[model samples]
Every structure is written in C-alpha cells, then in structure tokens.
Target: MPSWDNTPSGTMTAAALSLPGAQPPSKCFTIENYYPKPTLPSQKWVLIKVKAAGLNRAELRGRNGDQPAPPEFGMFVDEFHPDPPKVLGEEFVGIVEEAGSETKFGKGDMCTGFIYGGGKAFDGAYAEYVICPAQRCFRLPETSLSWDVLGAITMSMWTAYGSLFEAAQLAKGATALIHGATSSVGVWAVLLARDHGCTVIATTRKKDKVAKLKSIGADHVVLEDELKEQLKRLAPKGVDCLLELAGPDTIQTLALPNLAKYGSVVVTGVLTKQWSMKDFTPALIPPTRKMTFYSLEPGQEDIEGVESVIADVISRVESGTFRSEMFLDKTFPLERIGEAHGYMEENKAIGKVVVTVP
Candidate 1:
C-alpha cells in the first residue's frame, strides 16, 4: 500500500553542478530536477522539506575548482555511494517531514543545521527535500527567527562560536582582533565576542563600512592597511586573540605584529580565496603564542558539542540579543541561484546571500 514510487508526483529540484572543473556560475550551476525525494536512510536520519539554504564560500570554491573534493566525497547519506552531479548547499532551515525512531523530533517539526558533507557527499538543501542525520539537526522553537535568518546562522554562527570559544579560548575582558570585519562570519564574531565581554578590534578594507562595523559592538574599527598602527594605539598590551578570517597576506602583514604574548590565533576562513600561504612559516609566530585552525567539519564524536553550541546560539537568537537578521545582505529565489553565486564571487555582497525555496 505504501509504495516508494507512489509517494510524490514531481521530482525535487536543485541547482546542480559538476566538480573538479571551472566555469562561470551561469554555466556551472543549473536548476534541474536533480533528485527524487530521499527516503529515510536509517533510524538515525530524517527527511526534511527545505525552506531556505545559505550559499557559502566553500560551495563556490568547490564549483570553481578552487578547492579539490573533500576526502569524504562520494559518500551519500553515510554510505560510500558515488552520486554526482552534486547539489550545492551546506546550511539550511527546513521542516522535518519524516523522522526515524531515534530522533527526538517528529513529523512537521521545524529544524535547522549545517553539515560538512551536504552538497558534496550527497544531495544538499538546494533540493526541495534533503536527508541528514537527525543528530546533526536541531529542532527550532516557534519564534520570531525567520527561515532566512535560521539558514544564515547555520554556517557563520557555528564558525564564530567555535573560533571564539573552542579555538581561541576567548574569555570575558579579553581583546580580539577580527580580520575581514565586513564578512558575515566577521560580523557575527564581532557581535558574539562583544556579547561575551571581549573588547573587539575589527578590520575592514572599505572605509564606508567602518561605522557599520563599529555599530555592531566593535570597540575600534581599523582599516586593513592601518591595522598594525591602529592596534598599537588601541591595545598597547596587544591582542589576546585574533580571528583570522582574511587571507595569509593579512595574517603575515597585520595579525602577527599585534598578537599578545600567550595570545591565540584562529584561522577559520579564506576570504582572500587563497588556500596556500606563500612565504609563511610556523616559526613566524612567537613561541609564547598559540595557533588553532577552527573548522566546522567534525566527526561523529563531536556531535554533542555541536548540538550544545547550536542550542546556545538559538537561545541567544530567540532572546533578541543576537540580531541574526543583520548579517543577511541579499536573498534570491531558487531560480536565481546563479545571480546569487555571481554576487558573492564578484565580492559584491556585504553579508550572507541566501536562496529561498518556494
């Protein structure tokens, strides 16, 4: 009576792309009926009706062949299955349409989460339906946080959380230097760090965004070129931590000089889109300093920690103190995914770009 093929009439649509190749966004990304709605893979997974998904720089780099396939490539729904034309979205907000036995969530429960392998190892939230581990997903409260805001938070907020707390050990009264202050993660880091009682020194290349960054809890905003000089005036004792979201060039030129003895530096992103750092060596850092690279790619063992942080972030977002909406620069219909990717690739977007599924 419950036939698999009898479930739905239409196929799920996604912005599909090829891998290990470079092409314009228009040519690389195409909207098509990419996948049929996926079935529950196990008692630990759930099928979601995706509402919105955020486009990230990782997906862009993967599409443009700027980065190679992750080692986990070809694994779909936790299996070593080779499925391609991959659907490209990593972070999303959706409603649980079907749930397995082990999940606390039931059918129709609204949810949001980010997964490292989504859009890579399997079909991602760019589709109308996506299947992911229920443990990797979190149920959301019926609150004022909209779908777009929830989607945007999945990647940027998680990175900010891990960078500030786990990687840098940022504590109240610490001083943080946030490179690339205009980025979505940079903006969130400034807010999150300030809320945690740290004095934030934010940096930006655009003079126009100085006031904007300062308004979001940055105690001091410095131009990227003037980072070293301004930092000396602002924090003569030196920065206790630096969230290096910029490229290696900034880390070499601006960040190292301002680091305090015993300070920590967390490298999380490459806004410069350069993966390799030329003329850089570990010896360049002071022996007293600590360096950590924060990545959201966690194994099964780290799920509880990820869940705990997501819960805390949701509580903060619902409290109205987090202001998640401020970081959304633009949103597009699913069909306009190309334009969205183009906007980010061109470095025109000031914050997160989201794709809204109808």
Candidate 2:
C-alpha cells in the first residue's frame, strides 16, 4: 500500500502540451507544448484511460490567461502560468486500468471525482491516460451512464447532493428555492431535491426555460427577477431551503421567506456580484435561520460517503430515475484545445461542453 503522507502514491506521465492558448484569427488555435511525460507512481492510484472529459469554467479561466496555478501546486507565488500549455480539466469520466494497493477500486471500473489540487499537482484530464487516488472514483453500473454524462454529472451532482442533503439538512416537506435552474448543476439540484419529495421552486432567467425546469420535476418555475414575488404568492410562508448557484452577486429582491423555521440559504456559485451581507446584522425574528456556502471539494471525512453518493447517482442515472443528455455542447480535439477554451469563453453553449481526446 502506498502511503499518502510519506510518499507519492499516484503515478504521473511526462506532460506534453501541444497547443497552449488562442491564436490569431487567421491561424487555427491549438494548445502549446510543454515538458515530456514525467513518470510518477501508481501504487495507491488508479490509472484511467480517460474516455471523455468536460469543459468547466475554472479550466476556461486557466486557459484564457485568467486563473493562475496556485502556490500549493508547486509553483512559487511569482512563477505560474494559465495558457494552453498548462494541462486542462479537473473532472473526467473513464475506465480504471489499474488501482493503488491501498484503494479498493480495480482496473476497468468507471468513475470521476473533483480534482482541484491545481493544474500542477494534478494534470488535466485532456489526455490519453492519467492517474488519481482511489478515493476520487466510484464504480458504475455496467449498462448505465454515458461516460460524458457520468464525468460531467459527478461534480455538479455531488455539489447538489451535498448541499441539499448534508449542508441544508432538508426535510421531506421542505420547499427548496433553486436559483439558476437552467444551469447543468442547477437542474441536477432540482432533481435531487424533488427525489426527496420536496417542493422545489426553480428560477431561471429565460421564460422559455420554464418548461425545461418543469420537465425536471420542479413544482414551480419563475423568472430570476420574479423569484421572491412569485414565491410570495405561491408558497406564502417562504422557502425552507434556497439552493443558490449564482453566488453572492444576484439581486436580493427575490429572497425566500416562506421557510417554516431555521430555513437555510446554500450558495454554490459566486454570481451574486458583491458580498455585502457581512455589513448587515439581521434581527433575531426569523427563527434563527442560517446562510452557508457550499465548497464542492470533498473533505477527508467524506471519502466513503461521497462514494455512496456516486453510486446512487450512477444507479439512478442508469435506472432512468435520472435521465440526462450529454452535457457536451461542444468539443475540441486535444490538438485544437486552444479553440475549445475560446468557445467556452464566448459563452455560446448552455449545458456542459467537453474537449474530446482524439
């Protein structure tokens, strides 16, 4: 068994970045080249032949010269880069080719986990094969879940699950006000909440998306701006839970007030603009409610529980209890990776987009 505390457990290959970032309008974009494969370890690691990987905003930020590789990733504070040369993608779904001795998983299993250890500590999933700790993956049903959806769903689905069940401690009869219902993660939250038999009020920006939210079993759908007023008339008492993916930037006019007692606001995204609530002190009349933000990073204590959640998601998706489309709105071959980042930056797609390994 490889020891995580004393030695390197997972094996890694020498990184080769072919295209790094966007190119001139006339020249087709591609990723840049980097060092050769650097061999690491696989003793306590699982080798995944990455079949598909999703395009996420964080990677987009790194690719677009916005997100810099942080200190923990081995780069000094002064020397980090976020161009196409940096390995991209944190989430991917693939078949495990081997397992670390310390881990319970074996080769040929399919799974995915959040990899926020930084672009340096963990190479991005846009590759032929890579390694991850055993705890980062979970087994999947033989006939269920497309690799694309499985890979894409894990992060969003887990966040939704953790936030609703663990973070919010929601009850069966609670009313969950879910913001950004059109988002991939937002829609998943609605499904998980509905699965618990909760009344979910889904909010979206486009009225055309109302039907989409309903198809996912939302009890009510309202425009983003109209969230508070519509719920005021619909639920009257205020929502018991608010699943916020838009972060702290969203306007507060739609605040949910129908919660019975000790309602909660769970924030996952940072779209709320400025976080000024720290300046305001709420009076103690609303039954001692709480506000919290969900960090998708799974903690050490949650290793096994997360695996259970992964199994549930895979089982449900395979059983038709959860029906999801390939979140891939677009794909760029490994060579055209630069262009892929550009597409995400352009904000053209609605669901999850991925860069397919050629």
Candidate 3:
C-alpha cells in the first residue's frame, strides 16, 4: 500500500486535500497517516471503521478555498486543538468500532452520518476510520444496498429535504419547478416532491435525461431553453416552489417573480459552478413571494435537528420511498481518490463519485 509515513501499521491512510506541504485545487491529493480509532474524548462520540465515503462538490470548493469561516465562529477557536492536517470528505457508511458509554449505538452496528467538521472545521471522512458524534450517526438496515449508495444518501437527501420542506414549505398538490433537475439534490427533490403528491416540473440541459426524469415521477420535463413555455403550459398557475440548484443563471432567469402569491424559491446547490448573480435586486420579486438562500453549514444547527434530518432521510431510503442508488455514478478505491476527484472535476459524472475505504 502507498503511504506517506513509514508507520503504516499504527495508522490508517487518508486522502487529504492539502497536507503540511501540499497546496490544493490544482495540485494532487496526498495519502498520509490517519489514526483510526483514536482515543475517545467523551462518552458522546463513537469511532467508526469507514467502509465507504462519498465525494461531494463542496469538497472541491473547500479544496479551492471557496468557503471561508465566518467571523463570529472564530470565538470558539480556543476550543480547537492542534491536530494533523485536515482530511476532505463529508458523508460515509461504516461499522461502529467503539460506541461511547452514553451512546445508544453498539459495536458492530452498520451506521451512516456526516462528519461535523468535514474538511473545514476538522479532519473528516476521507480516512479508513472516522470518529463522529453518536447522535449524528443513524443506524442502517441490513440490506443489499452498496456502501456507495448509502454514502450518497446523507448529504444530498438531507440538503434536498431541508430545501423543499423546511425552506420552501412545499406541500401536497403544490407545483414545484426544479432547476438543474439532473443534479443529486434536484433528483431527490423530484422524488420527494412526487412522493408528497406535488406536480414536479423538472429542467435539465441534457435532452437525453428528460425521459429518465419523467420516469422518476417528474410530471413534466423540459430543456433549459424551453423552461418558460413549458412552465406556462403545464403549470399555468405559477409554481408554488422553485428549487434553485443551477445557481445564478437559473435564479436570475427562472426564479424571481415566477411564483404563486406566497410561493418561495430555495437556492441550494450550485451545479453551474457559478456563485454570483449580476445586477440583482430584491425589487425583482413580486409582492408576497419570497426568495431564500438555504445553507446547511456544519454545526450551524442543533444536534437534535441534524440527527432528525439524518434519521428521517435514512428511514425514507430504507422504505423504498427514496431510491438511494439512483445518484451513484461510480466508485474508486481509497488509493485512487485522485481519480475520483478528477472524474468529478471533468463534469462527466452524472451522479456522485465515491471512494471505497478498505
């Protein structure tokens, strides 16, 4: 096995965006010493032997330094300890190696969750073993679903659930227009919207994915160029909610003033890789309609809320109401995580690229 340290027996290998001497974005990631099953600091934390870790676009953004810590968050800097270089993955499916005394989980249980720090605040799930708060870890059913599929569920489904139900106030019989309909969040939004008895109008730049979108319960699928006409024809009453996954271009062109009175638009994913909107003003929105930019920052919400979201999403996935395998594009072994990152950078992956940690 390739390693950065001579003591491979004592530590597990992890793919890090930038180790002590490594720079990011354009540079290759390095595998370095990652301690598996570290000392338990408190009775609320649990150690996990990572089986699979899912790659997300946010990790790329973190690699490029696109996200920065908020100023107020600096107040807690005193609580942080000097640790090894940060690892860069968020979602994972793993086996519980050690459950804390107070945790309800047990050893040998199959579990899944998002690392609270995740490449920013602390070292994350790009390693063979990860430690997370027990409340954040949810139990998984004994099913034939691949680890990659379960890994893909956490971030995407949680983001979709937050955006649709929490932010947009989506309801049964509502009309939802999802921009970037082929994205992971968009795909989940479509499925969830359909499951809730909503009329889903989905959009994608790829014409070939139209039928696939319809098969997943989209009431109407339209090319990006034909969005306006199709929305007018199918939903006549402006959509009740708009899922802005494509970012600025879609928000500027499709969101503002394009809703029923009291309708909302939740901006979530930026699949367009574009963040800013030019010449934008709140005046563009019609009276009574709202536009919200939703964000699920780590540690931003209470532990109970995060745990609830994870539990609900996991239950939905197991019940067959939400198909977890639909967004999986491919998997790579831990040593080839660079290839996985490269695949995602190329925009060739239709779904998620995961890394299998053995």
Clashes of 1: 0
* Count of clashes in candidate 3: 0
Candidate 3 lDDT over 1-358, as tens digits, reads 2111112234777776663323433365777765543445567777788899988776765665554333211222333333333677767899998888999889999888665354445557889877777656777767666787777776677778788988998989999998877776787788888888999998888777887788778998999888888777887768899999877666767787478778998888666666667888877778899888776544554556656666666677677766655666688888887777767776665556788898
- Which residue pairs in candidate 3 have backbone atoms (N, alpha carbon, C) closer than 3 angstroms, thus clashing? none
Superposition error at 282 for model 3 (Å): 4.7
Which candidate model has the greater TM-score, 1 or 2? 1
| TM-score list, all predictions | 0.84, 0.77, 0.79
Span of 10 residues, lowest total lDDT, candidate 1: 1-10
The lDDT-based order of candidates, best leading, equals 1, 3, 2
Q: What is the lDDT for 204 in model 2?
A: 79
lDDT of each: 0.75, 0.63, 0.72
Model 3 residue 95 distance off true place after TM-score fit, in angstroms: 1.9
Task: Give the deviation of candidate 3 from the true structure as CA RMSD.
Answer: 5.6
What tens digits encode model 2's per-residue C-alpha lDDT throughout 217-242?
88999986776678768777778888
Backbone clashes for every candidate come to 0, 32, 0
What does candidate 1's lDDT look like per residue over 89-145, in tens digits? 777898998888998879999888675577666667777888777656877666577
In terms of TM-score, which candidate is stronger, 2 or 3? 3
